[model samples]
Target: MSGTGEPLFVADGERDRIEVLHVEDDPAFATVARRFLERCDPSLEVTSETDPREALDRLEEESFDCVLCDYDMPGMNGIELLESLRESYPELPFILFTGKGSEEVASDAFSAGATDYFGKSSDASEYEVLAERIATVVEKYRTERQLERSEERYRRLVETAPVAIAVHRGDEIAFANRAAADFLGVDAPAELIGDDPLSYLDTDDRAVARERIARLLADEATMESLEERYVDADGNLKHGLVAGSAVEYGGERAVQVIVRDITEHRERQQELERYRQLVEAMGDGVYALDADGCFEMFNERMVELSGYSREELQGRYAGDVMTEAGLETVEAAIQSLLDGETDSVTVEVQAKRADGEVVPRELTLTLQPTEPGESFAGTVGVVHDITDRVKRERELEAQNERLEAFAEIVSHDLRNPLTVVEGHVELARELAEEGASGEELVPQLEAIADATDRMLSMTGDLLTLSRQGDTVGERHPVALAPLARDVWSTLDTGAATLETRDPGQVEADRTRLEQLLANLLENAVEHGSTDGQSSPDDPVETPADGADEGLTVTVVGTADGFAVTDDGPGVPQEDRDDVFERGYSTEQGTGVGLAIVRTVAEAHGWTVTVGESAAGGARFEFHTDG
Candidate 1:
């Protein structure tokens, strides 16, 4: 194209420089030819080589854009040099400029890989043809190299892409990348060649996939991303978002499909939906606020907890629900999160109900994550009504204080009087032994000593009952049968038999449960007598008409919990309701034991009740389901 003498229009400045190598046998001829070529095209820089051998050496040393050589040479002709140059510099432009003008030589120049041939004579215009040929060939070569580089970069991009990409040609896959092969459960991309892409889609999605593929292949329009179900080679169903567009592949129109595996994303979306439903139905209040602390979104539970309608709470500030102090605490926590000081925080606050009641609440606030340099966005909050919890904590504190006072009384007032009584009784016994007057007082002194001992025992019982048991922390699986037998062996029962039936394991505090069993068994041994006798070793000589035949205590597991029963005169129906009260006893026994049993049961969140057993005895049933 440049040989027609039109401008080549190369870039301005130094980029227009083109180097040319000229080989001729004669020094004068080579010199004149180089000057003529340079004068014709100011952009060309021509170097002369007298011998073809020297020209080959120069080519190996330096680079040139085009080569100009003559036909006749000492070692090698122009065509022969070109043949050798083609081995290493195959694409370098070579032009034959020789005085021997023959069809035979022209044909030989081209067949030997010369780019262009021109016959040279005494004509100065022939040099213009040589310059034109050099410019045209060099421009074409550079452009073709640039295009190859661009194609190489595009190939790398497609091969290394993150998402699955496949090109389909007439219902069969022509190309697939590694991501596509992995998504389709194939070992390599080559394995997917000539496979129908539609075969990977699930039955319900095949028709939609076909329609979208048809639209793209027909050059109608591109299809937007659509979620569809597909099956892998392992027959496991998965979710993908597919988008398709028409593309040229191997000189034919084809569909290039991009599939992004959305299975995990879809599952996460579904899980969030389920959590959203749960938040709406939960008893605690869940709400979101903007950076200014104005309500943006809230669950139904928030409305109920705040005693405000959706219309009333929407767009309202946090001050509508929390007091000023609580709002300040929440704001401070949010600032801490925004400052990267903490992840989340829980603070106690007072919430004002719509009914004008201010109740204690525990608010847990967490700031939503944002970009590193972004300001605080908002906060998600969960509010728990802690009114009942606060009240219970105060009651437990008072109960502990009362127990401390009772312990002080037992240790000082009651013990001092008992010690004095024992000292007097010993002195009276010593006086009787010394044959002093008033020796008859010895028997009365012994009786007083027995009463003093009984008082001491009752004092110890009071201390035992005062203990409400430590906080029942972390319940564990405890077997009941072994615990019952172990406690029964430590008791002072002589004839009272113990039995455990179907006493399975339960989740309970082991130490507290053992204490409960000990107290209950002791109560049974003390009252399980038909003749209303205190000692289990002493038999009832003349049994009452409708009394129990013998004392027997049994512990058995129930569906909801467990039961402890004894074959004795059952507690009266009138006294059943008050039996668990402290210091309430029917016989000559401290009621503190049963009261301890009730305290332990309550600590474990179990309800204890007194009823008549099947064998006409008092049954204490502990239900844990509440």
Candidate 2:
């Protein structure tokens, strides 16, 4: 098979042995043929057989590289003997040596699988040519036999490989092994023998996969190993890690594909994604650094906390966006983790925002170690923004001090004066009732009572605002339909029917959700209706010019969350953001209503924006986490 250094035929001067079985019934012709073959090649090994039956028996018992037979025998002719020899030993070269030189006989000899046909001749040169032809036939048969064995061995190995193995010629799969057939969900390799491999991929991926394969074949280079998905015969999907290399098979250039199943690996990857989502859903910021102390990955909260885009954080050093002091502290902590002195460390540090503001963050750093070592592979950090929390703590401490001071002032100064004033007023009223002129005393006493009531109301509102800031109540999915009904029922607008649209559910605190609905309903009732004039008793009658028509508040659910639209005068675009600010009121409002709306919305991680409504009025669109 591998004709590396083998000679074509034996040289003339060498002691070559060519076994020739001369089957001739006549003694005279047999002697003549023997002498002629010896003259042609002096090293010829000629053996004459008079009986055709004996020669046929010898072929079965012994092996010869070449056989010579004669035609027109009594028992068995040359053609019949050649057919028998071919069936038993097809690779052994056979030459027909007969006295008959008819064209019909030569054609019949070849048809019976004879390597060559030679007849009796007196010329020595013609006999030499016959001998040379026989030598060439023997060498050719030997090479062909070796090639057959090599091909058989290769076929056995390819068919029994564990992984899918396929040979692709250009775009078609020329040959696919048994494993390839099973991987493709086919019964046998023959089913995919001539099919295009790219047909197994999805339509979108077929063109790209084909281009990659073509490029690999064109350059005669191996394709890099990659994880890819393919559709099987049953229309089910299969994931695999595939590697391809260019090779020569069956005298043609082709590519070989080796594929390993990786479905379990892909499933594990999906599970990791689910865990990552659970972590990102938390309020606190979380991030991971690589072994080189670079920001490799982070959650959405981390991006919001730092006020930096994910693209900007990736590949950047961890200390690049931190304050100078914070950077030094973080670096030292990381070094400690890398040095194996700590498994995890927590510290308070300031993170510098994109706008150059330094926000205090409580950072908890844990060393994520590599396998079988104390050395750190990276660090996982959970950062909590404590700016508002710290501010609230200080404010609570200050409020406690103020409350104590207020109590002291009221006990010693205000309460004592109030008691004296109350006694004086009572005495003056009694004297006035007894007919003493005391108009000024009566007016002063009423003024004191009004001032005291006003003070109490102011204290109650302040306390309510403080409590709202301190408590983050239980949050759940609040159905907007019932909440809107409750707020609408409390409205005091006479003769006005509140039209409520289908507002879907939102995740929010129960009380805060109720408060938000209450504020919007009250605003629609108070400002949406006319200032003073009353409407007619009949619902069909319209009010006067100064009186307002009944307002329609439409609440619609959106993909993001919900929207509330009022058919009232819309706010100008320039004042939309300012309207949400504390103490910003256009209609002499206490200005705490919209501010409370904003605070509650923000507390529940929702966004509220003002825009023009479909009714050509102010629309407030709010979104909650769905």
Candidate 3:
């Protein structure tokens, strides 16, 4: 369809479309060239431009598959135009067509980025060769453009990711995309592009990181992970988890490092460690198990209570060392916990020790969820050796039965005789009144009344002691602050002052917590004050050291639970274990107060311990589930 003498046009019907631009001064040659291209492929869209300047304008206006230009023209020579077109669209295939083809001119065209050079020859099929060469160059250019776009998209994705991503070449940081640059506190990746990664690490960690990277590159490991310390832009040391993997970069082998900040996680782990230590130091046993009911961890007290060595019990199944019935009970308790039936479960069972001895233990299991959407993995159990407690309870029960029999005998059999004696005394007093001796008999009657009152008080105390273990109170979250205030307000000793600090909450029995607080407050007021006065000039000084004003009560929350501190004389180290025993008071009052506190706390499955307070006095900490 091109005019006569115009370059031959090719139509590639198999392709979606084909466009060709032909520039020639002779209309006759363009006509012949276009016919030859159309015969090669019937769908060719060939446009002929006789004016060289017009051809350049057309090329600027539209995209063409290939351009065929003649060597000689009126205003612009073909070689000059070809040089200009290559500057703008270097990848567009250009073929020089000329009537006079010299080898020197052809070499010049090829040097100017021409695809190929050809001459109008006598041979009939020369135009066909030119058309075939144009098809090859155009297809190659399109493929190259697609590859460029794909690489561009991939580069953009890596630059915008949230996690730090870096590329390394040998030991140098070759590229650290945007996220990694910001994490390392650098202006751009270029700043660190050529720097060795060791420069960013601590002196001691540099060799370690380098070795890890080397091992990764050698294929000895798929990935290497370590905790690395680095000085940030602010010159402060920061902790991060460094993970490295092998990669090929820029035609050379390298390793990629991913740094993640773990400062908060590390701090939390340290806090848990401190809590574990505190629990291990206590008299009660503590055990932490994993999801499969295997012992993941346990404190020394737990090992001692179960009579098992720590090495022997760790990683063992709980059911293995327990009696068959005990194992069944524990499994049911664990199943209930997993099914969300209860937050905790308590059961008394006998456990076989490492030496094959069986001990009675009261195990209280509390479930803690480590992550959301995960099954109840394990329980933290507090086990107490209650064999001795049970023995003492039985002894006290027998004593109570004997006392009850004696009371019944005295009231029914002895009281009648005593009443007759009192009546005879009263008649004697009346007769004496007539004889003027009633005043002397009045004193004797008053003594008998005093003795009876003392007996009644003793009976009341005995009854309270007997009923202590029989009562099982419901447990709940009890806030310590308001409870302490109530206890302080109820004490009628005007000379003694009460001061309480802010206290958090703990899961415990409200009545028992109040009772515990009252006992401790009364103890502090009685022992830390002189002549019932809490003033500075009192004979008994504050137990706290210099700059401390006076005895004060403070309740504080801890990782395990809550603790009550008092700025009063602390219990002697030797007496710490004995202070919880019944009738062991150092003061004049009966010693059942602290004993009651212990009994109530133990009933709720909590551990009570004595330690030094921050205020330089006794601290009683109760570990209740919070």
Stretches of candidate 1 exceeding 4 Å from the true structure: 1-359, 362-392, 395-470, 530-549
Residue-pair clash count for candidate 1: 0
- What tens-digit string does per-residue lDDT give for candidate 3 at 1-626? 23221222233312434678999988887888888877775446677889998888777676677788899889888889988887777777788888768998899999998888888786768757766776776677656765766688866767786656777855788878776776678887777788877776756645656666778888836564678777655566667787777788878788877777665678888999999789978888888887657787888888776666788888788877788888888888878877789888889888877777887888898886666656566778988889898778876885676456446634643453456557757766776877856676766566456445434533444455466552447768777778888888886433545554556777767876776777766665555543332221223432322123455667677787777776656665767887676545442234455666776677677888987777567788888762
Give all TM-scores, in the order shown: 0.37, 0.34, 0.36
**Which one wins on lDDT?**
1
**Which is the winner by lDDT between candidate 2 and candidate 3?**
2
RMSD (Å) of each candidate, 1 decimal: 32.4, 32.2, 32.8
If the candidates were sorted by their lDDT against the true structure, best first, what order would they fall in? 1, 2, 3
Q: What is the lDDT of candidate 3?
A: 0.70
lDDT of each: 0.79, 0.72, 0.70
> Which ten-residue region of model 1 has the weakest summed lDDT?
1-10
Better of 1 and 3 by lDDT: 1
> What's the candidate order when arranged by decreasing TM-score?
1, 3, 2
Clashes of each: 0, 0, 21
State the lDDT of candidate 2 residue by residue for 86-196, as single tens digits.
776766778887669999999998888888888767776777888787778766776787687678887677779777888897668898888888889999999998898
Clashing pairs in 1: none
